[model samples]
Target chain A: MRELTYREALREAMAEEMERDERVFLMGEEVGHYNGAYKVSEGLLDRFGERRVVDTPIAETGFAGVGIGAAMVGLRPIIEFMTWNFSLCAYDQLVNNAAKLRYMSGGQITLPIVFRGPGGAAHQLAAQHSQAVESLYAYVPGLKVIAPSTPADAKGLLKTAIRDENPVIFIEGEVLYGHKGPVQDEEYQIPLGRGEVKRTGQDVTIVAWSKMVHAALDAATELAKEGIELEVIDPRTLRPLDDRMIFDSVKKTNRCIIVEEGWPFAGLGAEIAYRIMKEGFDYLDAPVVRVTGEDVPMPYAKNLEHEVFPGVEKVVRAVRDVLYS
Target chain B: MDKTLMLSLYRDMIRIRRFEEEAARSYSRGKIGGFLHLYNGQEAVAVGAMSAVEPTDYIVATYRDHGHYLARVGDMNAAMAELFGKADGCAKGRGGSMHYFDVAKRFMGGHAIVGGHVPIAAGIAFASKYRGEPDVTLCFFGEGTANMGAFHEGLSLAALWKLPVIFICENNLYSMGTPLYRTLSVEDVAVRAKGYPMAQEIVNGDDVLEVREVIRHAAKRARTESLPILIEAKTYRFRGHSMSDPAKYRTKEEVKEWMERDPIRLLAERIYALGIANEEQLKAVDEAAKQEVAGAVRFADESPSPDTATLFDDIYYEPEHHEQDEKVVPLEKRRQQASV
Candidate 1:
């Protein structure tokens, strides 16, 4: 096993995929000459050259549609949004063309493209810059949404997303880029729509994804000291969710708590809570509680920003409430 | 011009005119649904531009794209079937009149979104250049689309990358109801090309020959030099924007004025002046077009609706693989097994 930061793992996944397939190219604002806005694509331009590692203008709608068009003609394009927030500019291309082309074309066309970027609250980037849009993308029927929470998962899931013969929305946590963890040295791939249990317990289940996976893990550790065992599940892929794994965990633990960085209204956790109530209600000892970000524009101040979104304390409290009930 | 070429162009334009008339009738009769933007007056632009490109070249158009699809695919039956939402339609009825796609003919699609398809056209052109293919992509949109951010972005990328794409702006005097002058700051849509440093031209969209000549030049530049060109075709839609629009925004005199310079009548006059054919021959061509359109309607009426079971199909590729749940032990169970 080799240790790599989340940033390095993403770079490796892209670099390896580009080498494996000539059609695979990376295009985005500041992705080439600037290495990357967050340097997640560092050294790719030098290795893959300007052809594959393309630096585009600050036109998300333009470049995102360009990627879709390229994919329409048998090319695999990896479009990087500077951040998920900027992806709003290209929402039509992502939601309309890329998603509907296959279905509209009656299977005559396939859009093998990936729209990936840092998402959710990052420091005090404020309202416009900080948004968790995975739920918005997951609502579309033709899209495949993946939110990887760790370095290994990032590498594995990204590779899988690029190879998948459809439009995929790959959401990377803005804060998790620096987190280092063990990744396999050999070539590997993690299947999309699979949930992985980071820590297993019996009293309660904590289901989280992306950056919230770390929060759930921390809460699990803190709860262990208090003799409250908790099972932590990371749903790597959001759209084709591993529903069985989540239901099984909730049934076994007899209680469930969902944590997310998005707002509570119609958020990922809201959907999960609905599913748990619908399918796993018979085995549940208590109601499924959701720990989500406050329903306000993220604040610029550090303290307010921290309070806006979910964290370790929030996850722990939600788990405690479910366990106690 | 050669008599055969002149007659061919006339036939194409007349075919479009008849097809649009039929589509309008269908809409009026409650056979068609959704927003139907008819290309009644803008036939010359689609016919002329499509004539310049090869069969292998790609084409993308806006919601009012029946003419473009007919020009590219030359399949009147399929086009009508698509409007009828029949399974045998170009898009298998999944895409209504607004989205007519024929991958075999290289007609990308007719996107209903105002300016959304511009970048897609550029990207298709980018793929052509990347793959060393000689194919060029032609993107057609209304003047209203020029005001969208996608227009700027798509043009900038196409110009910057020197992608092989020809952008045609059919300035049909109005975008739905907003007049071009009211919406766009510039008089000539081609003037916006300066921002991208791309070559551009303004052509009389009523003159099919002039439109064809300009598109031919643009297509040549795109293929040989890998340069993108924008051409603004001054045209107008004879009917209201859609079936629902009464078009009271413009005066009856304005409609009459545009009708006087109708694209089909202009081409018919040109054919007569060139001694290609007389009024009788032109009348025969018009008659043929009517028959062709009638046949198309019959085909559409006979075609079956798409199977209900296929409603969920084509949404994703190999969805079965994604549906399967993987077997895995819980973290504690794995740890316990490792300890044993």
Candidate 2:
């Protein structure tokens, strides 16, 4: 295994997919010439050429729709949103067009396009710049939502997303791009909707995804010092959730603490909590606790920003509460 | 133009008018529900522009899309049945009046959200360009939709990528109850094309010949040069925005003024003036259009309602390729484990 940064893994996935399929192409603002806003698509323009690695104007809805239309006509377009927060400008195209086209057209059209970009609170990027919109897209029936927490998962999940026939909302961790992780030299794909139990334990089940998965793992390590073993699970795909994994983990641990960077109300964790309660009601020793970002919009102040989103401290507290309640 | 072409345009415009009239009647009788935006005075914009494009070209229309659908040779019975909420409708009754779709004809859809379909139209054009196909997409929207962010986004992308798309803005002067002038800063929608740096033209929407000539050139340019164009067809609606509209926004004099330039009447007059058809032949065309509409109504009345058993079908295309991994337990297995 060779170590690669999350950014490099993403570029490799895209470049490999483009070489394999002529229909596959990348288009977004600053994707070409400028390399990429985040340099995730670096050197792709020169390799794939300007036509395949297109640089689009700062029109999210326009290019998003263009990707959808191209997918309808048999082109697999990878549309990048500089960040998921900017995706709100193209929300209509994502929810109204890309999400509903298949159902509205009676399945005559398949929008095999990936709307991917960095998401969630990163550093001190204020309210507009920091938003975790996975719950919003996952709510739609026609969309497949995936969040990759590591370089290997990023590469594998992205490849699967580009090949999938349904519209995929690939939300990447803005903070994890620089994190180095082991990535296979050969090509491989991680199936969507399969949860991976990163660490096996017995006292409590800690569920998270994307950047929060690392936080949960850290929380488990901290709780381990106190002689409490926490099983950490990363649900790579959110929409077609791996209920069996979550339920089985909860059934064994009999207590669960869910963590995410999205807002508390109606968030992905909320749905997971509901599903766990509905199915594992009798197995629970205590109520399932949720550690989530504050309901208010993200603030700019460093201290307040850190307080707004969940971290290892919040996850640890939630686990303690669930275990001791 | 050839006599046959002139007569055919006249016939298509008449067919749209009569079809809309029948739709209005059906709405009045409570046979059609939801919003029914009739395309009465704007028939020439659809008929004329659609006639210029090849059969393979795509069409993306707004809620008021009956004319666009019929102009692209969409099935009359299916269109009427869709309005009637029958299973035989174009969208299988799932999409009422505002969401007619026919994949076989390459008529993309009838999007109800104002200005929402503009980007999708650009996407269709991008797809065609990506495949090296000569297909051009005609996207129709109202003057009101011109002020939307999507209109700007869509047009900018179309021009930036030089995608083969013709943005046809049917400036009927009113967006629902609000006048176009109130919403848009510019009097002519074509002026906005300067922002996108795309070629644009304003055409007499009531004159079929002028619209056809302009759209023909625009479509040809899109295919040969990969250039997108904006055509603001100055037109008006004869009736209210929808079945529920009281139309108190404008005066009767204003409606009457536009009615004087009615597209169907203008085409009929042109047919007669060019000696393409006599009064008897024009009368025969009108009669035949009325009969065709009557037959559509009959077919809709005979069609059955959609089967409730398959309500969830077509929500997603589940091919064999999407088979679940063996490692991932199914929902039923999870439920069984929970019971234990």
Candidate 3:
């Protein structure tokens, strides 16, 4: 296993895929010439040339729909949004065109396209940039959503997404690009809709995803010091969620707390908690709890931003309440 | 210049006219639901423009799309069945009237959102250019789409990349009920293309020959040079925006004036003037269109509604193996798995 930063792993997956398939191309703002806004696509322009590694002007709706159209005609296109917040400009393209083309065409048109970008809060970027939109996309019936929290999952899942025959929404962590972790050197793909237990225990299950997975593991470590063993489940794929893994964890632990960076209402945490209580009702010892960001637009103040976020302390306190000890 | 080509174009325009007329009759009879966009006076734009391009070239159109489908595929049963929401329809009843698709024919889709299909049309052309294919893509939409962000972006990208897509704006002078005077800042739609700095042309959409000639030149540039061009087809929609629209906003005189230049009549007159078709021969074309539309209505009447058992199909492609056929789980599978 070779350790690589999340950004490097993603680049390797793309570079390898492009070398393997001529039909595959990367198109986005600053993805070329500028070596990617975050250097995620660094050195790709030189390797693939301008034809495959295209750089478009700042028009998300334009390029996003272009990618869908290309996919409709037997091309695999990866459309980057720079940031998920900017994806709102291309919402109609995503929701109307990409999400519904296959279903609307009655399967005559299959969009083998990926809409990937960084999401969730990063530092004090504040209200507009610091939002999580996985739930909004997950609620749509046709899209497959993935939010990989680690370098390995990021590479494996993105490789799988590029080769998938459906439109995929790949949400990369806004802050986890530089995080280093071990990834397999050989070609491999992790099947979507699968969850990984980063750290397992039996006292209580702490389910999370993306950046929250790191927080859940931190919470687990602190809880372990207090002799409150915790099971941390990271649902890499948000849509077609790996709920069976979460349910199996809950069936073992008999108690659960969902941690999320998104708002509490109608968020991924709410949906996961509802599923746990619905199917694993008999297995529950207490009500399923959710430790999520407060129900407000992200604030600018660093302290207020931290207060809005669900940190390790919130997860620890949520465990004690769910445990009633 | 072929007599058969001229007559076939004439016959195809009549077919779309008759097909939509029958669809309207069915809608009034409560056979069809949802939004029904009728292409009454704009038949020549589809027939004429489609005729100018090769069959292998891609085509994308707006929601008033039955004309484009008939001009491209012309399977009345699928077209009428789609309006009736039947399983045998082009999109297997999932798309209904607004989403007819024929990938085999390369008639990409019947997109409903205003200017949404413009960029998609460019993307199809993008693929052709990327693959070094000489194929061109024809994109048709209304004058109203010119005001949307997607329209500008699509045109801008096409010009920037020199994609082989011909953007034809059928400037029918109305955005639904809002006239161009009310919605557009500069009423000349072709002038907007100047900003994209692409080659452009304008044609009288009512005159099928003129529309055909203009598109022929544009398509040639697209195929040979991989360049995009914008064309404004000055036309009109005889009926209201959709089945629900009363069209009371327009004066009877305005509607009556545009009807005099009706696309179907203009082509019929041209056929007679050229002596390519006579009263009996042209009458026979209309007669055949009437019979075909009648049969389509019958087919739609006899077709079955899509089964509830497979409602979940086509949401996503779930392939069982690398070279294996993709499987679509039944719609109930999601609900079934959710309960567990």
Find the candidate with the highest lDDT and give its number: 3
Docking quality of model 2: it rates as medium
Worst 10 residues of 2 chain B by lDDT: B320-329
Which residues of candidate 3, in runs, are more than 4 Å off? Answer: B321-334, B337-340
TM-scores for all predictions: 0.96, 0.95, 0.98
> Which candidate order results from sorting by TM-score in descending order?
3, 1, 2
lDDT for position B254 in model 3? 94
In candidate 2, the residue pairs with backbone N, CA or C atoms under 3 Å apart (3 or more residues apart, or in different chains) clash, namely A66-B123, A69-B123
RMSD of 2: 3.4
Ranking by lDDT: 3, 1, 2
Chain B, per-candidate TM-score = 0.93, 0.93, 0.95
Could you give candidate 1's per-residue lDDT for residues B1-340 as a string of tens digits? 7788789989999999999999999999988898788889889999998888899999998888899999888899989998899988989998888889988889898898888999999999999998899999999999999999998999999999999999999998888898977888999999999988999999999988899999999898899999999999999999888889989999999999999999999888888888889999999999999999999999999999986645566788875623532534455653432220
- Which one is best on TM-score? 3
lDDT (10s digit) by residue, model 2, range B184-274: 8999999999987999999999988899999999999999999999999999998898888989989999999999988878877777787
Docking outcome class, model 3: medium
True contacts kept of each: 0.75, 0.66, 0.81
**CA lDDT of each prediction against the hidden true structure:** 0.91, 0.89, 0.91
